[model samples]
Target: MSSGRIQQALLAWYGDNARDLPWRRSRDPYRVWLSEVMLQQTRVETVLPYYERWLERLPTVAALAAADEETVLRLWQGLGYYRRARNLHRAARAIVEERGGRWPASAAEWRQLPGVGRYTAGAIASITRGEPAAVVDGNVKRVLARLFLIDEPVDDAATLRRLWLLAESLVPAAAPGDFNQALMELGARICRPRRPRCDLCPLRPDCRGRRAGVAESLPRRRRRRPIPHRQEVAALVVRGGRYLLGRRPPGLLGGLWEFPGGPVAEGESPPQALARALVERLGIEVDVGPRLAAVDHAYSHLKVTVALYRCRLTGGELRPAYHTAARWLRRRQLGDLPLPRVTRKLARHLAA
Candidate 1:
């Protein structure tokens, strides 16, 4: 079958089975852009609430542009990969300042905006402006790779170029947005990464990988290195019902708040590390006490084991050195401030 026939089949399936998501209900570029950003590296269910709340708070591009960075970051607290939030804010400001609140008309123009890559620009332009731009996110990549039975490493530059070309060819002129979305939906719900329900797929008739009985393995993946693990320490410094929290420097989990601490250096005990971190990060000395909790958290490439120690300030004034800011907040007030997941868990432990 030709690509045109496959596009029609997918569109028919989409019209009948497309998810009634909030973003799908509107053609507003701002809403579409917001949903796309929030959905990056995050599950739909996890992003739903954040998307709703963000739209409610920053209803328009102008509002988002006017909002402060801290407020935006706080709204995006639990949604990891904070760089997305920062870029969204930057893009909003650019739109407001550069275009006087008018969104870019085409995918190419959208790509010129901050953090608006090819996939994102295509999504926004097609979904909102009816442009015939193709999006090749992970879901779309998997779908096309299997449908065409491509076996090259999905991350290879040549493979990516070939997939993008395939996606562009499959995008129909009419309702290109729906065609693109349908492709993604089919991949997400039917042609899943594992245990794909080929029986329910609209494109099953044309799937080369299905005929070869290798649909699940068509998109070859590169081997990943083992994630390195590190030990760290945090000081649970409290005084008069307030706990001390410090803002991270402008890197990694930048602009977020967390308990003051640092890595457990070589040959150093947790308590010793906590004491050292307190002096180095906060410009104060603390006498480390008993262990409060040992929390394990994993990032995309790093696994950390943080030993939380109860500590008392023993010398020097509380001053911010390495951190952006430092504050002592009561238990109830901590909820209002943005905190990392581990810090929130520690807060709950303290409250209990």
Candidate 2:
């Protein structure tokens, strides 16, 4: 029940039960930091291959800093949340060029880097530098909420602050990193959000929510409003067996390649939308053809059903207005470019 007892139980459980992940094999700050960044808003299963591939490609901060944006985005193509990849690239440059390649040793110092929030900074600092920093990610918040029988919505500003303080208090002076990771591991594997295996949990004896018969319902989140849905269209304009791709400008889904298209206005058909988008964005006239595929994709704030259509460029030269660059890429060259997931879906359809 005491903080010392909790820490002891957690660290022991972690020592025995932790997964043999590649990043866990070393205390090297770069490896630790890179793993943490890649794992943000992503599952370990999803991140595993990407993590391995990333390390193989750009193993060091200097390597990442030296890599071009296209290369960085290519490695991170399917991982989504492209902003994370961009920020990681920027942070690497900052570390190499500005910080003289020295990794930040504390959570506060790590926070100064791009995309390194409090939770990420804490994980990096504690794991690699042995700083007594608390990490309050979704997993940690869930564990803490159930352990303490917290009834307030965990997403509430006040509730979040309290949870952070509680996590800070439980961090051990020795092996604080192990303690933080243990708590997260417990939440991830045992004290899960749904159907938590409380019997297997290290904190079962001390979990107040389990005792109160409400562990499943603790760590409540505020009701999320319905995400807006948009109907999008893309044109598959191929010439001489080469497909056209456009590079997005530096913003949402930035620095990534895509089949040029735009959102469908209220009553416009997919074909009409595709034609208008091509004219406005690329300054080329196109005759929209049959629909090739329709893919549904969701982002944090929006859901889109993208309809891919085969089209032929009819009139005018290819002059891109919204995109930074436009090119007709050969089939073999597609693998080297970084494309959005929806675009990849369309590409696969074309290949099929």
Candidate 3:
């Protein structure tokens, strides 16, 4: 199949069918960069409000650079995996300091900026500078592998590297940004992960997967190892009607409240782990009780089997080195706290 013909088809398809996302409003590098960063591991619907609110709060590189971390974090609260926000803040400072507060104009120069990965650099360069750089993100990988019927499992490292080369090869010099966006849009909207609408695909006729009658089967994936189950005992330490909560340490779900818990080490029981965690973290020794309930909470990278315990503190002092703050809040007020989903799950189980 001719690359030019495929490009024409994709471009036409994009014009008619692309999602009307706010960030696609223009080729502004800063807005594009911000949207790309915010969208990582987040759904488009989820990112929309955060992006709008964030842009309204910090309209320029200088604004973000000058903003304090706490305000930044507060704005980014509930977004999850807050390191992206922090890195965005850090990179903004560097741009304002070294690059005269403008987004670096070249892909190589953009790559030099903090938090900017290869795919992000490709997006920034293509969108802003019209550079012929291809972005081999998940969407692109799915689209290309099916279009060409590439049999390499997309999850394999070598196969992914091969896909990158193929992505670059197929990226036409003319309107690289639109081309890249078109492929991504097609994959997202039409060549979906499951139950794809192949009949609606512009590349349907040219798609090798379709030609070979394997449209649903191509772009094979290496089976992902099931997320390991981690067992932990959470202290639902109740003094009167109030429960103990600790702020998660900075970096990765930072600043959120959690009923303290960690993995149940080999051969150690949940009650024992809870007892140890309380003393180690808060200088408190507690009497472990029967399990209040167990919860299965799943996050992006792992699944946790959490055992909740009703316990009383026998003796100890509140320590704050590992936590930003520790507090005993009434059960009703626990809902007001910005706790992790797992912590809220614990409360729900306890209430039931």
Candidate 4:
């Protein structure tokens, strides 16, 4: 079957089965851009409430550009990948200042923005600007890999390049956005990683993987390296009904507030690590007390276990050494500040 016929079948299926997501209801570029950014490495169910709440708070590109960094980060608290929020904020400002309040008219132009990569740019352009651009996200990759029966590792650069070429060829000129979205929707709903619903797939007739009896196994991926684990300690310093929190320096979870702490050295106990961290980081001596709680969290490359310890300030003046800033915040006020997921969990444990 020709690409055109496949497109027709897919589009027809899509018109009947596409999920009515909030972003799909409008062609507004800002909303589409926001959704694209949020949807990266995140699930629809997880993003729904965050999307609704984000739009409510920052209704427009202008609003997002004008909002303070802390405010934006606070709104994006649980969305992991803090860099995405920062880049989105920067891109909004650039769109307003450099483009005179108008979104870029083409995918190429959108790619020049801070966080807009090829896939994101293509999605925004095709979906909102009626541009015939190809978007190959994870869903589309799975769908295409199975459709063509490509067995190369999907993460390989050459394999991905070939996939992109095929995607570009298959995207219909008319209603390109709908066509691209249809491909993604099909993958998300029918061409899923496990137990794909090949019977319900419109492209099943032409699917090479299905005919070859390997639809579920095409697009093989390389094994990931074992994630390294580390143990860390945090000092829960309470003074005058307020808990002390320190701002992380500019990097990974940058600018987020958390309890003062650092990784435990080899053979160092949690309490000793906390006590030493206080002396070196805050220039204060603390008598580390009983362990409060232990929280386990994982990042893309690292797994960490954080042990929270109640502490008393034994002596010395408080001074910020490693942190950008340090503050004593009430439990209620902690909600307004940006916090990493593990820190938030620690806060809840303390509150309970």
Q: Is candidate 3 or candidate 4 better by lDDT?
A: 4
Error of 2 at 164 (Å): 0.8
lDDT of 2 by residue, 1-352 (tens): 7998898889999999999989999999899988998899999999999999999999989999999999999999989889999999999999999999988868999999999999999999999988999999999999999999999999999999999999999998899888888888888999888999998988888989999999999789999999999999999998998999999988778889999999999988889999999988899999998898999988889999999999988997898899888999987888889988777777888773
- Among the numbered candidates, top lDDT falls to 4
When summed lDDT is taken over every stretch of 10 residues in candidate 4, the lowest stretch is 343-352
Model 1, residue 145: C-alpha shift (Å): 1.0
Task: Summarize candidate 4's per-residue lDDT along 1-352 as a digit string, tens digits.
Answer: 6998899999999999989999999999999999999998889989999999999999999999999999889888888788899999999999899888988989999999988899999999999988999999999899999999999998999999999999999998898999999998898899999999998999988999999999998779988999999999999999998999998887879889999999999988888888999888888898998899999999889999999999998898889898888999999998889999889889988863
Candidate 1 lDDT, 228-253, residue by residue in tens? 99998888898997889999986778
If scored against the real structure, what TM-score would every candidate get?
Answer: 0.96, 0.96, 0.87, 0.96
Off by over 4 Å in 1: none
| Total clashes in model 1, counting residue pairs 3 or more apart in sequence or in different chains | 0
Better of 1 and 3 by TM-score: 1
**In model 4, what lDDT does residue 308 have?**
94
TM-score of candidate 3 on Cα atoms, chains taken together: 0.87
Give the C-alpha lDDT of model 4.
Answer: 0.92
lDDT scores for all predictions?
A: 0.89, 0.91, 0.84, 0.92
